[model samples]
Target: MAEHPAYPVGLRLAGRRVVVLGGGQVAQRRLPALIAAGADIHLVSPQATPSVEAMADAGEIAWTRRPYEDGDLADAWYALIATSDQGANTAASAEAERHRVWCVRSDDADAATAWTPATGHSEGVTVAVLTTDARGRDPRHTAAIRDAVVEGLRDGTLVAPHHRTRTPGVALVGGGPGDPDLITVRGRRLLAEADVVIADRLGPRDLLAELPPHVEVIDAAKIPYGRYMAQEAINNALIEHAKQGKSVVRLKGGDPFVFGRGMEEAQALAEEGIACTVVPGISSSISVPGAAGIPVTHRGVAHEFTVVSGHVAPDDERSLVDWPSLARLTGTLVILMGVDKIGRIAETLVAHGKPADTPVALVQEGTTAAQRRVDATLATVAETVREQDVKPPAVIVVGEVVNVGVQSSPKTSE
Candidate 1:
């Protein structure tokens, strides 16, 4: 007769006793899972690694400070034997079997009744990959298969029908930087289900090209001019489509709230009695700099980073930016939409307390295939921008942190 399947069941060990033998590497790894299961864990070992010792100090687990014995299994609902000594493993398994408690043996799986599977957690789902082991699990080449499935799970590629339901509402999704793959899982899934997509100039345009032919794609860039007029039209379009009982996706570049005018749309929809949901995207202010191998904030060099818009020149009366205040800040300063006014912005910073020799970096078309970086100083950045012929949709970083991550020009800001 074949042994009963080791019952692939999840144990509610919470508030129940769980025993772990040996305080070495084996126990170190198993204890975390046991702890996560809310089990009352007992560690039986005279010596333990510093990490285990730290856990004990924090009262996360009970340390017996002695070797395992038969009595240890008396109250344990589950046990794991990870001692290097085979005799100790055998002894613990024997005790657990007599008590009808399942025990896992790290030294010899064939002799054990329970096996630990490779596990991963994504979203709200917990996945366990059981390779063919003594417990009749598949072990022959599951790594590649496991990775592919897990990737699909994370990117929402295997979204269910319910997830893509054609509900009448507006989903304001922030496409991270310019990478199609950087969009959030929920954002990508919503895009697939969108009846109409209102796309921004800097959004992940590549992803839009892959949308179904039936999906209506509205190019926000071509919308008529005047800032207020353009935004009002976008808002009206979202409300109009959603009211028509169709799902509308207001796709914007970077994060919707981070200078993307997302809140304005949300407020507009609310006043119109239309349902609106927000799906935040990865902001280029941080990710763009990172892709260029520059740390916006580093330990000793820069403790903070400030992201602001340079679309309005500092000399312009309409510009609300306090250039003097920004210049006084010793931390990194990141400017978005500032390519057109970089000369004035740099000049203002220098005229203020900021050093003329401060390292400056202009990253154009950041986080995209055409991404390019040109290094200069605050004093000569305008000339560099002209020399490099840099254009809009760029990120300007001014600080010492840029120097730490990558090699900067010996050129002075003066």
Candidate 2:
């Protein structure tokens, strides 16, 4: 099989007609890119995810509730077939070729006209990672590689190809969980260049002081549990300032991609054809435990770690996770935004065969000067949290590794 070719220059698919023939999670994931590229998207699928249905209901894209037909390729500049059915995907790819449209077949690696690279964007520049083998690898591996590249850029070890002739604009970075010193070097540089700074309520205030005094500051901050500006308004403000050619920073608390809604803002900017880049930050899920003297993974203690959100919809049962596998695994489990659901979560874990006596720890304001740690067992974590006043912007770590902190910490002044 022939390998896919890498493009010397990334194509800006703005204002193109892109047809996506699937409505599953994979299709839903790809839709954002097409929408962000300002494509006139025509979706053909027998079923749709909530996100897809929402977009279609809002009239954001044209939708056909059926499988792809030959006529579905009419006037499309690009086509993506992401159905679970391999035969359906092959047929769609064949149709795309007949219409001379650029095509990507999710199931058939050799049939794609172009491969979707693991992309990272900053300002107008886009860095894409393309494996030599066109066969799409596992997403978990792809994510790991993307993370490594992002970390390299953050630390200045991976210097992207820069046209020094063009000065880059400011990037708003999520400094991650807490530790002020944990701020990425790229984030620090952007802070230095920022003509204006807008930050979230949870971000370390001391980190903001690092900026030059001449820089204007705005406190359009939002707390996870507090009132704040809607994300749409925030997106508009960021673009409006950038459109004025002013370097602006809209800093968040943690890694922007991990539940920070960074992709939504990125999509909004892409829709307007405004170039913006995302600088990934350390997520609290792993870092918080590390700061609390707990390693997420330890030999013979934990072999895997699963990170999940606690605030998913109740009616959306799909969002609810498999507590049994998580409980049975000999690994660490971290839950974010789950303080309120601690009781129910504990019940589920216990019912699913996790020992009621399994160690659990709640680390609040992690990585900051005012950090606090509350230790308890699976049976008593909910009560312990209430007694200790553990709050949001915190991480709940459950597993054998949770005992590491208790054993390591010496008695200190309360």
Candidate 3:
């Protein structure tokens, strides 16, 4: 039989009782939204999945631990009938109907008084898609539409800039180990909304191409071993653009705070009374070795991992790292910006208590194309680097953990 089209509406279930007649996959999937809405949820089920039981244990919901009863829907503002027992679901639906509470049935949508739409959230906006037919509902189609809308909104393609409240500020966004897909969702969304981007030489460079034509992408002149004046210039540029009421993003490689001088930029902005939002990216210290199939820490291998910058030579007074203490430890050591100083670092460790034959791996351009791994020992790493002609922006992993999970062949990347 033909039926009227389903009407769409948002439910404000805060501080209201919502009864759920199942604790299986359906309830497990839908309960989070209800809980997030501040609903007083009561779940009735004789058995529940471990995740649902965890919710009950966490006191997020009240679990009856029994099958549906006649008065279970009493005083319920909303009801979800998803019990495996069809008779129990039917009885619960009938009770919800008698009480005039809207109910959704999992097994029998035809008897449902309400339909749940496929929903997605982006930038404080909720996108919900629903399609009803006399034959059947196409959940996959609705989900695809919902995904498309959310993606468009998140990437700024569907955004109406005129309707948005533009607040000019600086966002120190971590671009994450040179991979375009590795950046955080918030960071990507902010980049999409940016009016001007002051980007570093490293990081996800491909994303800059996707920015709208109106966005001014500035290649920040941050030369390796450059004087402090270069950083000062970048800071001045950020402040200047933000003062002009333009939303600016300082996109950097890996995490902003992890040897990226992000705190300096944030401090600079703070002194100017400008708002700065820091979005963390995946640090290459851990991610690089992992990408090359080397776990920084492994069971029964290395118990701890230490990350330190190799920007300054061990003999250099500017170096803050305690090389002697690191050499004494048996844990894994992940070095960033240390490709040039690997020979000095290796000699220092070997001169200390560290073994000369300790396994080491250099992961260059990790988590992206042109990535490669070079394996060597502590005594031979300096020579191996020279032989291999490895460059900067490489992560040097030291310790036996480099040998664990060794799936990638030497000098090759997938």
Q: What is the TM-score of each candidate against the true structure?
A: 0.82, 0.57, 0.96
Cα lDDT tens digits for candidate 3, 16-72:
999999899999999999999999999999999999999999999999989988999
Please give the ranking of all candidate structures by lDDT, highest first, separated by commas. 3, 1, 2
Residue-pair clashes per candidate, as listed? 4, 3, 0
- Tens digits of per-residue lDDT for model 1 on 91-192? 889988899888888887777777776666655566676654344656445555666666666654554444555558899999999989899878887887
Model 2 regions lying over 4 Å from their true place: 1-170, 222-229, 313-320, 411-414
lDDT of 3 at 208: 93
Backbone clashes, candidate 3: 0
Give the local distance difference test score of model 2: 0.77
Q: What is the C-alpha RMSD, rounded to one decimal, of candidate 3?
A: 1.9
Using lDDT as the measure, which candidate wins?
3
Query: Which residue segments of model 3 deviate by more than 4 Å?
Result: 222-225, 407-414
What does candidate 2's lDDT look like per residue over 134-221, in tens digits?
5555656766787787655544345553445333343658877877778776776576567777787766577777566677777766
